[model samples]
Target: MTDFTGSMGYCEFQIPFFIEGVRVETSQMLVGTEYHEEAEKIDRETAIVMPLTKTKLQDKKEDLNFVREDIQTSFVQEFDFPECKATLSLFGRADKVVRKKETLIVSDDKHVSNPRRYDVMSEPYVGQLLQVLAYLNSKYYLGESFGGWKEIPCSTKMYQINIVDSKTRSIYKTYEEIITEEHAELFLDYTSKFIKKCLELDSLDHHNSKPKCKACGYFSDCSHALK
Candidate 1:
């Protein structure tokens, strides 16, 4: 129930505004973009174990090179829609880049307490899927921009690894979700819709009330706060 317009993360879409003489920072006019800083805080033990585990995994898998070593740790991508004179910005980093035969695989590694494959159609993983899609799509645009662009078949996937523990050290799962042309189109549609909605909301004097308002910092001052 959190307000999307105010939430902050790796990818954010906001509309800046002024309300009752106060300037709102998250308005559509200014979509706040953030990165690595907001990443989940892992415990000391997990942080220590992560690299060892990753190295072991890498040693076991051939022809796999963590993208961390090949490219910048993080990057930002943006596209402007000339059709409507609107712009979309995205920022994220892929976990791994692997070359298998002729196909390139762009993958994301996720560590979860109870690892399991997620349905691409579900909401919980939409943001994650969008991230991978952005990575794959960005490569195409980048190739075009840089030239020497040899079109190659590539795919995006994710690996949901179980948390590392004594009982799970030998057990983990890899999940791969295909990012197709349809998903890319869907992302564009949603992004455009989100931008339009954010701008529309920015022009309003009030927002609809929801349960999450109780925890929002602006609750007391919000005109739409429930009584």
Candidate 2:
């Protein structure tokens, strides 16, 4: 259906290239001295797919043809993963509604701040986010409204949660079917380490990240490029 990769309120880039004059496409070769380096590179990718109907596919194509636009109205949903943990994540635009009008609460901090939670360099949270999404996909599909909230509350707090499974490996079945807890103890340890690693990476990214030019047309002023 509709294919998208988003950073929401962050660096969003799209590359459109013609497939012409290309008979084949392949990934780059990994370079490393140690055998473990090659092994690490093997886990660099995870594949996930969704079921789509003809109508949904057409709608997604229309949304993608010109530009990819994100949903402005925020939504929240509480998730109960396979691990028996109940947690929630926020979705929607930064400029969109923050506190729900009637209820007036910020139930999820991730929704209001709109930062990259699952950093590429982070340890556990990155994989955890993937694992959680994959688990959710197995049980249900993404719905239009916030599944967790009847009305977004007035005050919201932040809490971090991690998801892991040993039965699922990229080398085996697809991501959707693989998010299961086979080795809970080991997965928890690795994922926890990954979380701290990603936090440090986030701090570095914040300091070094640059804003777009002031003269750019897509943005109003350079000062507003998300500091």
Candidate 3:
């Protein structure tokens, strides 16, 4: 159980949210930089749930149409506008890739105790949509061994499989995201600005927002946090 506020590495998922959190935590070098051992326990627990969910999903893959798991992907490309000339290295791993005949469904599992609180169409889980699209847009984010994988599905759609704790309740069920080209393009545009903003960061810049603070692990030490 590693418990600490680690520095941000370039990750392909939830780019904006992670950037914002880092900016806040890094604002006051004196206080925020110190690692809060207790804060990361929740994150560790969350991470632990992933492998368990993946194992369960793996068992049902054939029936659920999952094609692959833990697929590694990386790419370097220049962006448009403010991010121009900057070659960003995007890297990530997709938890599962489901085959739906011709269209490929790239799915990432999000485990929560009370998943009913997060509606797929709401803002809370919107980042999941963005992250999953990154995997799909990068052509399923799979290695060359999956060369037979079709590109059409990659361009067309993706998914997010929300695994809620069924034992906690009677009606808790998993939700799925149906990502489209519009969703992908919107997130890509956001990524462009995200890259530019990240490059421009010198000192930590913090935002005055309540909801973000609630979700931030470093909020207790963040002097600029509203909460």
Candidate 4:
């Protein structure tokens, strides 16, 4: 979903790699993967098992009591939207899921080589936002039994982490926004159309942006890559 939404040619260009079970890995991708693995390990080791009563669970919905619950990080979730026949399912992993006070927060962590590159941007990229929205929507509509709460307010967050220098600037910025059912519907509609177009081999040309092409892991092997 992120690739299809972020880059014009990524989905088409990656098809061969996927078929061959070859992942194009860059240094940045490796670093991000390592960091997430370490974080997940630590979270698992230090996670607390808390017991909740029926009254406390009810209070959680009404915001009557202050409760904090940290869900397992990097847990995979699948969302099935039968209404969109073209692309009936989507899957994503949320970096963080927490219920603080009255709101459920879904966060995605992005590890960047340099944080200064995004200083001009006011918020997260559209693809990043959508990724988190997918997680939020899945949890809201389908995770009542797992999450132990329902009909509560939900929001999405993007944490931009500076991988190069954590002491000076660990977290560069946090982009946040409220997510709703309408947003989820709109996302599903867009994704369905996008998948249908991909199936028809429509607009499979490279974006032709030199910077993007150079940064792409598949640039060395991609036939359509910009020189």
Candidate 5:
């Protein structure tokens, strides 16, 4: 197995969060130009969607940290759903790892037309979430540094905020922090791209309707509305 935490630093700005494919972005989060310098550039490029086709690692073994405590690795494989992709992160003290033979539960709704929603918040495995994130980080930064369409989840519980140039790295708040949905969905670069994607999908359906089929959600908003 590859040990990613040998001597390198922690992931810069990514937090632990999951994606439900569709994302949303607004103009309210356009601060901290320097903090999001790298991420902003990455946003323009096309993402090479990651394919974690492999199974999640099941580790029941315990690791003794420097704090003089035996911490057990209690998580087997992650669950895969049909409708939406889930990224789970579990916290708490567990004795050992546990892997459910059955696929973990996923959201039931397949027609998610909205953004800023996650399927794993209700129920998810922490181990699976970490594994998937590590995989994505490896693919995005370790091997070939680039962007892609693979949905990513991050937790910014432990992060180091730094900026190389002035105004490049400024701290941005979330909606909850700013008391508004617009701020909660701030564009910190990494998430900005996803939010932009969601906007594109929304705009396309609103403007150009290639087919006059009844399945279109924006049929009412389309130019050629059927009476």
Candidate 6:
């Protein structure tokens, strides 16, 4: 969903690269990768894991009843939906899940060179918002299957951490109404159209933004890239 909303042009330009399993690593990508690796390592080292038994679930619920925050790492959810006569699997891994007082706050952390580019008061980038929404929506639909905490309310959050200055900004939103099956179906429709376009390699549909083309990894090799 992030790729489809954020970088459809780039994805289309690099279709051949993706098919051949070739990745173009940029300096920015390397830096972001390193930051996530270090963060994940630290989180894993400090995280406490407990078996999800009935007793444990109750204990955890009681523990979270108070105003407390639990940092859950690599929170993953997956679901399968029928789309266009085929089953489409949607999966997302949230960076952190905070069980705070009857609310499940799904947080995604983004490491960026400059944090000033993002504004916390405004809505997050379309792709980022959708990515977080997908996680929360799936949790809502799957109910208590994964954990018994689905009864709690769900919210979305984004942490934009600055790599250079070590600064952070957070954007929070509660999208209860948008988490319905109707919205999920709309998202699936967009996904289905995106997949079909990818399969057809629709050259005419490429983004014509020169700034985006210049920043794309496949700019040099993409014939449709805007000059």
Best by lDDT: 4
Provide the lowest-lDDT 10-residue window in model 2.
1-10
Q: Residue by residue across 1-227, what tens digits does model 1's lDDT show?
A: 01222322111222232212334333321211111122222222233332223333224232334323233222233445444455544444444455453345665443333344333323335545555555555542222233422223333333332222222432344445555668769666655555555445323233344654554445566555655
Between which residue pairs do clashes occur in model 1? 14-27, 14-28, 15-26, 15-27, 15-28, 16-27, 16-28
Local accuracy of candidate 5 as per-residue lDDT tens digits, 1-227: 00111101112111111122222222322332222444435533534433322122222122211110112122222334343443322222211111123221110011122222432344222222323223222211111222332222222111111112223232221111111233223312223333233333212122232452233333343345443
Candidate 3 residue-wise lDDT, 132-209, digit = tens: 656666633333444522233322354655543433422244455566567767766656655665566323344445
Q: Against the true structure, what is each candidate's TM-score?
A: 0.45, 0.19, 0.56, 0.68, 0.18, 0.62
Estimate the Cα RMSD of every predicted model relative to the unseen true structure: 10.1, 19.3, 10.1, 5.6, 18.7, 6.6
* Candidate 5: Cα lDDT at 58: 20
Kindly list the per-residue Cα lDDT of model 4 for residues 110-172, writing each as its tens digit: 777777767788766666666666565553322445353343343332233222333342567
In candidate 3, stretches whose alpha carbon ends up further than 4 angstroms from where it belongs are: 1-68, 82-84, 119-124, 140-155, 166-178, 201-208
lDDT of 3 at 114: 52
Give the candidate order by descending lDDT: 4, 6, 3, 1, 2, 5
Q: Relative to the unseen true structure, what is the C-alpha lDDT of residue 201 in candidate 4, on a scale of 0 to 100? A: 35
Off by over 4 Å in 6: 1-16, 54-84, 139-186, 201-204
Better of 2 and 5 by TM-score: 2
lDDT (C-alpha) at residue 38 in model 3: 24
Arranged by TM-score, best first: 4, 6, 3, 1, 2, 5
What does the lDDT come to for candidate 2?
0.25
| Minimal lDDT window, size 10, model 3 | 1-10
Candidate 1 lDDT score relative to the true structure: 0.39
Using lDDT as the yardstick, the better of models 4 and 6 is 4
| Model 6 TM-score, 2 decimals | 0.62
* lDDT on C-alpha atoms for all candidate structures: 0.39, 0.25, 0.46, 0.54, 0.24, 0.48
Candidate 4 clashes between residue pairs 3 or more apart in a chain or in different chains: none
- Better model by TM-score: candidate 5 vs candidate 6: 6
